[model samples]
Target: MDRETRYEDSHVSIGSFVLESGEELPHVELAYERVGPSDAPVILVCHALTGNQFTIGEDEPGWWKGLIGKGKYVDTSEFQIVTFNVLGGCNGSTGPCSINPTTGLAYQADFPFISVRDMVHSQKQALEQLGIHHLHAVIGGSLGGMQVLEWGILYPECMDHLVPLAVTPSLSAYGIAYNSISRFAITKDPEWKEGYYNLEKPPAAGLATARMIGMISYRTDDMFQKKFGRKVKGNPGESHTETTYDVESYLHYQGNKLVGRFDANSYLYLLKAMDMHDISRGRDSIAKAAKLIQPNVLAISFKGDLIYPPHELEKMFSLESMAHFYIVDTKFGHDGFLVEFDKWGPLIKQQLKETLKI
Candidate 1:
């Protein structure tokens, strides 16, 4: 495995698994990172798109260190935190990039479509195989947040608490629109080869452009203006003559960063899963979807998030009489819940206190 893509993590074979679409995977493997006490209430930390099972690190810096540290919202002393690379993810998990045992080639375009429910079911199978029948909570943001809601809907009694941050019951039309454009950027690229590209000639430009599009949606316009304005990206003392905008430079940097570590097909598949994430699809209505969530729900909404704005979450969770909701006022947009710790971190701690009595 390329170091840029990923190295192996703690893995558990989940045997044969069937997706919600009736597609069956002959064998499934889930790569995860578990930390904290050996015997303690479990806190399942789901990762966002493009993220892996490196939430709480040993020799490396964990992705959510600011929020999952020693004295952070999810205090490790009181709970064991386990995070897994989503089933359709490339990071040490079975994904479009993984080999299909029957064909002895990467799944690629041949990989069956998966939904958020499929991801939740696979994770549940993996956990149960490891003798974990119950969970303390499911914590995640954005893509991870979608998984959190799916876990609550699919296996309501499997967890005590559900902390879904910056996400709604389903990806809004606006969100899907963004995903559609991103996928188009990848599929149209010549090097993409219709999802059959090898490692040597991956769709670098297309994936990078898709990531650039995603970077814009992740943060707010106000944030970009405040951070970069109309400044030129160049040397400190260099003359600003026909130079790239600072904001453009930042987007390019983010795009390149993802292209280096992520598989383009995995990105497309995950986006499709997100698009198929509607608890109401088979259940009839969002109200019914809310009704299926038996666990204590604590969902956070962001005022600056334009993609899946706070009003959408407010309207959906409103269907559930007992669901707790918090709206944080921040300038960071959809990524705020993932970036700024002070805003939503305390809310998580409070929820943990009420649910776990810690």
Candidate 2:
């Protein structure tokens, strides 16, 4: 496989730090990679749930390709984009699938529980190692967007501009419930065996089910209706019936693909971290936490995104010192930030020009 086709794996050690659960992770290692020019202005790109460092256009063109390459929104010609798989991700980072240096086997269920702040701290170590004194901007969507918000709060001094797309400060009660159900589905599978299923026979059924649950929320009702709409398209003849609507096939493809690249334990870990994400926790109220953000903030949401509704984003902005907040109207729902790049690319370019003055 080409170097770019294979996942890039690199690590940076973060000296001792205590976790939210009162556990100590000494010398935590973060995994990351850089795209575009080294001397260019730095823009840290955080991926959403299940995403890795391959954030720019590659293979089939990454979800953010439209806005990130040469002469584009992020404009690699002027900005060096750094994307990292989050700390607990299965890609190249230390997660459940990683071998335990002590046990000489995959960490499995023994991997330490982590938090969003913990992930950011690890990324901070990676950035410092790369000689980035400060960032030109921090940008992300969904859970990635949550990381951007955390960056503003935890390391305000290291960032100049903050762009959080399609996300909120904390998971709503509904969101928490959704995650809980997904976790339950995974744990209930016969093959899970408390997160230590046989590697050769992983709990693919459970993981696919969990993904199906998530896909429902990540997209819009209208999109499903238009794409599926109870229409049954016959599949290739086989022993078992293989018929589905366009949307059903799409969802199944997404679910199966996730099971191939992602580990069940890592998915559970990251979901829990997202559930625990509340910027206001012990710091202040939501409004107060938002007020502490000193850098120019840009919060973007999609009109059709039911998962991170536009109103919720507005609530976050109401509490912040924002340079601008925009809702890009689209039918693409939460995934709009990735799919409707044509609309947002120019807008992002405009924002960068005004803020970076490039």
Candidate 3:
């Protein structure tokens, strides 16, 4: 919805897409954006949990513009960049907000659970429809990173390089706990009405609280201390009890921002998918799963990230000769991949140039 430069925007019907859980979406619509020449080397950029296909070129600046564009990491002039809203996303894609073709009503809670592999399978279907069989690189961070990890193993021959940034192969206990807290905050809202409530009366309060919890988990103590600390805003001790501290006001702002633009049910589905992500699931062991990855991968971790710490990504060493690990030294925590792009940009450029020759 923001200002973007020249790009192609369209929706593709991918027919019925089946999830790994055996649940099938009778019809799936994927909204996507493409930039650069059709025949150029392809780089598929998977977005984060709440992100959509609008990677760049919006009237409003894109969420990840710092790592993309003319001279950015995935320069559009050199590589055909592709990004798609995932199968269950609400942004121009078939999601809980989309009407069920059969029942003629929004799917809402009726939408089945999806996994990281399912998300990758959906993207693969859309890409195949466009005749894109090979990718110069597959890159993402956070939830998107999980998809990248799945793509490496699921379609080993489809890409030459894999970049999974600030992500864990599976959600850690702490990660799952955080998601659970967020989900509870949303579901407990009486107005949710089991996900069948009217659009105008959405569970804003619950959704905002959920986002507040997520915001807290996304940053480091140092980052928060530097940005907010115990600093009181205005006469908070007298004027407002709720926003007494700068940190409280900041969290409330973030929560409201997300609620204004995102769907609650979609958030639940995506967070559940994250909880279910495990690169080794059904593969017997991590070593066995690592064997399935064909591309040379660069696994990046942020030093102070509590969500997906650097030590967690070291598990990718199971990929052995095919994987190289790097820790991005930053105080920004898990969000460093987004906030400290200046530091990540050069590393990505160097790796992509050397491996994919892009």
Candidate 4:
């Protein structure tokens, strides 16, 4: 298969799997990348929304390269690192864009909705199939952070440490509003054709608009002001200037870049999964859920993260003795946990060393 059609590292069939919604997928293929020696300590790096299995590579720089290098937080020289595309992702995973083995057609709109719990459970099964029964740590940020929490709560005995960054126990109403608007933008595009359009004619305009909306939420107003201010992309003296603000140009560039790689349907599915993340769903309260986590937990909050501000993560303190929390001061907002490695990397290194006794 072409590189674009499947992951270049490794791919495996997960066989039949059922989602939390009772929808069954006849087959699920997971594309993943594993690094270092198999007998070494295992570190599972869960990706954020739109992220794939390529966490660290030589061909192209990865999204978390600064935090995953040789002597970085994960310390690839000492630990085996594993990462994979989410079940409903387009990057070498089964999703709406993948062919339905039963029908010989793309699942498209027929692909059932999935929740964060479903994603965690599916990953657990996949790891078991790969002969990985335990992990030294599970680390993630943003949506990936939610998965970290889910893994701790769902399979407490499977991991020794859990590091969740820039995420809360559940989605806030404000966060939901941002995600809803992004989804609506995609569905409104005429080319969407109710999610049945061919890949060649997919809703590019709508998906681009959706990405622009997501980009706005990912960064803070202070970050925007500091980075762009009133700067104009070109000569504002031109009477017919099509663009005036540098922020506008940045958002457009980010949107176009994502449109070229991501599938609109996968975007909707993953966002919905993020919205459905709730560690305390049936546990009655956040405190009760925290009690079930057996591993050492580190919760990292970003100062300007409007989506999951430090206050939102205060609930994690209920874990009491097992939990440690830290806030990184930055103007990067929710994306700070991804970009401001200088601020949080030391903490990660310290904690990983303390937890694993490295």
Q: Could you tell me every candidate's TM-score relative to the true structure? A: 0.93, 0.91, 0.95, 0.94
lDDT score for residue 349 of model 2: 72
lDDT for each residue of candidate 3 in 73-182, tens digit (9 for 90 to 100): 77777778899998888899888999988799999989988888988988999999988988999999999999999999899999999999989878899999999999
Greater-TM-score candidate between 1 and 2: 1
lDDT tens string, model 1, 1-358? 1111122249999988888888898888999988776666888998988888999787888889889866678877777888889988998888888889999999998888988888888899888877789998999989899999889888999988999988887788999999999999999999999899987789999999999999899888899999999897666546555446788778888998999999999999999999887778888988878888998888898888987788877777886766788898888988887777888898888787766743
Best by lDDT: 3
Clashes of 4: 0
Local error of candidate 4 at residue 143 (angstroms): 0.8
Which pairs of residues collide in candidate 4? none
Q: How much does candidate 2 score in TM-score?
A: 0.91
Better of 2 and 4 by TM-score: 4
Q: What are the per-residue Cα lDDT tens digits for candidate 4 across 50-94?
A: 898889865787778899867686677777788888899999888
lDDT, model 4, position 336 = 87
RMSD of each candidate?
A: 4.9, 3.9, 2.9, 4.2
Model 2 residue runs over 4 Å out of place are: 1-9, 15-17, 57-60, 235-243, 319-321, 355-358
Model 2, 282: alpha-carbon shift in Å?
A: 0.8
Q: Could you give candidate 2's per-residue lDDT for residues 1-358 as a string of tens digits?
A: 1112222336666666577678775445666767765655678999999788777745557657767776677777677788888888987876788777677888899889999998888788778877888888899999999999999988987888889999988888888888998899899989999898887788888888899889898888898887778776665344364645677688788888989988999999999999998999988788778877877888899987766778876887774545578899887888888886887767667666655743
Number of the top-ranking candidate, with TM-score as the measure: 3
User: Order of candidates by TM-score, top first?
Assistant: 3, 4, 1, 2
